[model samples]
Target: MSVRVQADPNQPQAQDQSFSAAFELQGNPDQGELRLYTPLGSTAAGIQWTPINAVLQAHGETRQFRDLAQLITLVLGTDVPVTALFAWLAGQNQEVDGWQVDLSARNQGKIAARRMAPALPAELQVVLDN
Candidate 1:
C-alpha cells in the first residue's frame, strides 16, 4: 500500500487539527473500496493490545472498527474516550511521525493514537525552507 499525506503546511494551531492532514491511501491492498481519499487508514488485525471482534470488508480486509470502546480500554488502559485520538489528530495543531499504533478498545470507544511524520521529499523541503 502507498499512503501519502498532503498536510496543509500550517500546523501547531490552537484549535482543531483533524482537517490538517489530507491523505491518499490506495493500492492492491485496498481494491474495490473508496480508499483513495482519507485522513488515515489502518487495520485492527494483529493488534494484540486491542483485540477486537472486527468487521471484515468485502475483500476480506479489516478497516472499519467494530468495537470502539473495548478497543480503547485495551490499548490505553485508561478511560480516555477512543475518539479523542481521532479528534486530536484531525485537529490542526499536532504534527508528528513514525509513531506506534496506539488503539484502545473499551466500553467507551476505540481511540487511535496520532502519529505524524516529518516533512519529506528532501528536494521539496529544501525548496520550501528558502
Candidate 2:
C-alpha cells in the first residue's frame, strides 16, 4: 500500500511537508506492524504497536511511544483512523468523524480515503498485492 499526505495550506507550519511512501501493513490495528520500504525495495522503517506501547525502528535506532496513536502521529504528522481502516479493508464502509473512506474498488483490492476536517488533511490509498 502507498500513502500520500498533503499538508493543509492554511496551516503555515504544515506547508511543504507532504510526503509519499509505500509500505506493507500486517496484523490488526490493536497489535500490528507496518514496514516501510525504500524505493529500491529494502526495509526503510518498521513500526510495531500493541495495546501497551509502540516501537519504531529505523536508521539503526529504536524509539518508543506511549501508544499506537502517538507513534502514528509522530511518523505520519497526523492522526489516522487505523481501526476504521481495518474495517474498510475488510469491505466494511465505516465512517470516521473527520474522514471519508471509499471502498468501491475493494473487489479489485483497492481502497481510498481522505481526511477532510481539523487540520493537515491527508489522502490514503491502498492496493493489496495479490
Task: Please give, for residues 25-89, the per-residue lDDT of candidate 2 as tens digits.
Answer: 88998899999988898888999999999999999999999998898888877788889988998
lDDT of each: 0.29, 0.84
Question: After superposition, which runs of candidate 1 have C-alpha atoms over 4 Å from their true positions?
Answer: 1-45, 48-52, 55-66, 92-130
**How does each model score on TM-score?**
0.22, 0.88
- lDDT by residue for model 1 (1-130), tens: 1222333446554332221122232222112111222344453223211233423233455444445455433332322223333333333223234333332332233223433444321110000000
Q: Which ten residues in a row have the lowest lDDT in candidate 2?
A: 14-23
Candidate 1 has its poorest 10 consecutive residues by lDDT at 121-130
Q: What is the lDDT of residue 23 in candidate 1?
A: 28
